[model samples]
Target: MSSPEHDHVATDLLAALAMGDDPAELGLDADARDHLASCPSCTDEVAALRETLELIAAGGGTTLTPPPPSVWEAVKAEIDRPAGAPAAAPAPVTSLASRRRGVPTWLATVAATVALAAGVGLGAWVVQPDEKDDATPQAQVLGEAPLASLDAAAEDRGAAVVRRADDHLVLHVEASDLGGPDGTREVWLINVDGKRMVSLGLLPVGEAGDFDFPERLLDQGYRIVDISFEPDDGNPVHSGTSLARGEIA
Candidate 1:
């Protein structure tokens, strides 16, 4: 009964459900109700939302609290960096070509495909079956991870490797390299994928912090944690050069 026209309305209604609004309180009227009753697609969604709502209730309710003041300050500082003020990326390995040149394309493709399949299989084995699959909420919740203090280990150096003690590859930035008239700003972040970098917050010019990342991003592909110096250009991407750099190793 509801065509794509009802999409936005349905989504808003579902979001309210997550906040514990009863369906009757949604004021959906007749068409939305007819659609929900007849459409397996919409019914399934409602079920999922109800489950999520229950989880939120038992999970301390839900709130979209803004990040702390320090995070905003760091964000504003990073946005204020200048152009052409990036540190250089590490030099390419001269021997890399020698190792990769003679490899056949077909063979390389096969190897890559196999590697991807293995990784997927490994991940499926780890996801919990259902929210209620475990007797304790802890079993359903992801474990907290701590990356090593590579952030503080190499502060104020010309160039140093910033490796996470944790096996998952992530970043540790240095503000000393990203000098500015206002001062310096550095951050360690995990690649939340191609969209954006999850800032570990501004790194202390000389101190270290927890900088934890969500476990969901643990297996995504990433390497080459970059550090850039802000020159007041108002740019977001790297400045075509890196001020400080390190490999995943």
Candidate 2:
């Protein structure tokens, strides 16, 4: 059995790997590699995280595009604005594209991947008009899974769970081109036996959302991440029409 120290190292290694860091460059010693080779849970976690990262990176093309100067100027203006002021009207399409370009492609992709994996929006880092002090909490990534399309028509999906400082379990989900016109998409946590299940919440189409749940549910083995299409029938059960599914490591 691995000691607590080794397990901590393993977790750090997995997080680094998820961020697209080179394991060797991260100073993964021989002992750490050996532990990873022997621990099935750790191995599976690493595989899932790597797959998710690859999917995110693949979605972004190889070339890097720069944003226009106006985009930076607007962002700077917003940041420089007095606290408690109302946010200006939404920027134009060209400005939005410029804002996206302003961020380094790799950095933006990594942030989006992490945020999506953590059930947060890509705008987490964006400065808002809020005047008060804002602090970001540190979270420990527990595990992840790649959502597989149930059918050829389904789009790509991924999910990860993180343990917040307060010990809450937060699920981060990402979906692409997976929305349906019939109804909104809902998230579910199901057991391996497929008998017990719990609804986390609804997910925005083609975007990411972080849903929090009591950690005890996970302790009871509800680790399957599922997305389903639910119509406006006012029902509170699984739709039986699974769009994407993945098993958490």
Candidate 3:
């Protein structure tokens, strides 16, 4: 029996060859090539992978219907069957061509597994509603706010953007030059009233972050984006150390 590593090398080389790649350009060692030439099992596996890739490529160019849920259930049952038990005959898959050459049982199983996965993915894509269907509205940019440093000497800067899709609203925050004391930095959605603020989450320095809040918050006048320097003193209240502030328009 071939070592697992050798099997993997041969499988990769065979896959490349099957995809119209030249054997010489694949950098396959002479010994591995010789083994592939001499080993019947390796030969069968390479052929099976080639056949599988061809079928998948053919599928990409056409609108093929996906296999039914029952087909997936049958595949799952076979995979879950206990070891040493006889495998019941597999159900016929619709698009698979009849075998051109005899392959070992293991090779057939591998090919079937590949085909089943491809079929499942294709089926999922087919069932997805088209984006242009209009029943699902595309996200719209509600507005943006440019963050400015509260201190005249600080270089802190960022922008806040609000977008809405259907009933959901998301806040996107990006920051730069946000230098502050050695404490955690957090995002916040402060109500225009200035007394009530909700902590969105932590913001790592020099990274962009997104926050999700209810549409009702915008309706309730929570349109300010504030990033504050906070000390880890087990307090949830805003620390009053604003690094940058902006009001969403």
Q: Give the best candidate by TM-score.
A: 3
Candidate 3, residues 181-207: lDDT per residue as tens digits?
888989999999988989889886565
Candidate 3, residue 110: CA error in Å? 32
Which regions of candidate 1 deviate over 4 angstroms?
A: 1-182, 188-198, 231-237
TM-score of each: 0.25, 0.43, 0.45
* Candidate 1 residue lDDT tens string, 131-162: 44444432222222222323455444333333
What lDDT does candidate 1 reach at residue 31?
Answer: 59
Tens digits of per-residue lDDT, candidate 2, 1-249, equal 344234423333464555666655666666665666686655665566555456556753332232345444555565566777754652111111221222345444443333223322222233223332445546777788788778775446665555654758888887665645678799999988889999999987655888999888878999899989899899998989887888888
1 or 3, which is superior by lDDT? Answer: 3
Q: What is each predicted model's overall lDDT from 0 to 1?
A: 0.39, 0.62, 0.66
Candidate 2 residue pairs that clash? 119-172, 119-210
* lDDT for model 1: 0.39
Assess candidate 3 and give its lDDT: 0.66
As for TM-score, the candidate ahead, 1 or 2, is 2
